[model samples]
Target: MGRWMKPEVYPLFAAVGVAVGVCCMQLVRNISTNPEVRVNKENRIAGILENFDEGEKYAEHGLRKYVRGRRPEIMPSLNKFFSDPE
Candidate 1:
């Protein structure tokens, strides 16, 4: 009916708690830094190639159209962004 106050039992509880905390921290750290989380450019390109079709555009052009509104066009805005050679 009473809690265990034996001198030896306190250390056992403390040890178990520390071990569990360490294991949890390790799990969190590992999950955050997992190497398999990044996107693979080659795989993305291969997927697009697999679904290749005539008259279809590249992803960059598709993205430009989606953001800027209209059919996909392949003109780079870099010329406008950079200063003229004059």
Candidate 2:
């Protein structure tokens, strides 16, 4: 309803949505990386005290693994062109 909605409240709604998304992502990350919360049955049998290293490895296996060894440049070619001696 046009009468019920205010343009000024839109930014607040957007901010709240973003915050909720961030919180959900953090919750998922925490659950996935928690050593005690094993998803696999075999891992559950192995107990919480063990396989901490494996959990750490699992946490690092996605984008983090790929980016870990990469140069921290946004535009490597452009940077190289500027830095190179004529």
Candidate 3:
């Protein structure tokens, strides 16, 4: 068989894998540290909290629910509130 199509494609595959891994990692980190995104998330949380009384347990309950892989239904309400209807 010709060398170009041979089974020695390991190095080429590894190079492509490494490049894709680096790009994904950088993208995740960049998004995690974005200030505007963070602010919007905090504002959403605040909006959710508005339905509760002062010093209520809703915040803690939300954290627990989110950690348990549950998305609250109130998310749509918050999104609708924040979204521009224009």
Candidate 4:
């Protein structure tokens, strides 16, 4: 097996596996949480022509919930270093 695959290739394989796993997890999460996705048979036809504003609001709320209380800057100390004098 060592002859067929080099040690350096292992990191590449691991990176690819991690990326694929993250993509699959995100796909599942989006399908499960998205309000626009109607999984039920009855609700699909009943609200086929319903307003999309509610769904947009729900998406916005979800985004805000995730970003709540988190700092917007990636590196506050680095940002402060180059700022104008107070």
Model 2 lDDT on a 0 to 1 scale: 0.82
lDDT of 1: 0.57
Worst 10 residues of 3 by lDDT: 50-59
Any idea what lDDT model 4 has? 0.79
Over 1-86, each residue of candidate 1 has an lDDT whose tens digit, in order, gives 14687776889989999999999976774455433322567644554333444214333354466677643435546654564554
Candidate 4 regions off by >4 Å? 49-86
TM-score of each prediction: 0.37, 0.52, 0.36, 0.55
User: Between prediction 1 and prediction 2, which has the larger lDDT?
Assistant: 2
Please provide the root mean square deviation of candidate 1 (C-alpha atoms, Å): 19.1
Error of 4 at 67 (Å): 3.9
Candidate 2 accuracy as TM-score: 0.52
Query: Could you give candidate 4's per-residue lDDT for residues 1-75 as a string of tens digits?
Result: 877499879898999999999999878867776676778887687775566786777567756888898889888
lDDT of each: 0.57, 0.82, 0.60, 0.79
**Alpha carbon lDDT at 69, candidate 3:** 68
The count of residue-pair clashes in candidate 2 stands at 0
RMSD for each of the candidates:
19.1, 4.8, 17.0, 3.7
Error of 3 at 7 (Å): 3.2
| Residue 62 local lDDT, model 4 | 59
Which residue pairs in model 1 clash with each other?
none
Q: Is candidate 1 or candidate 4 better by lDDT?
A: 4
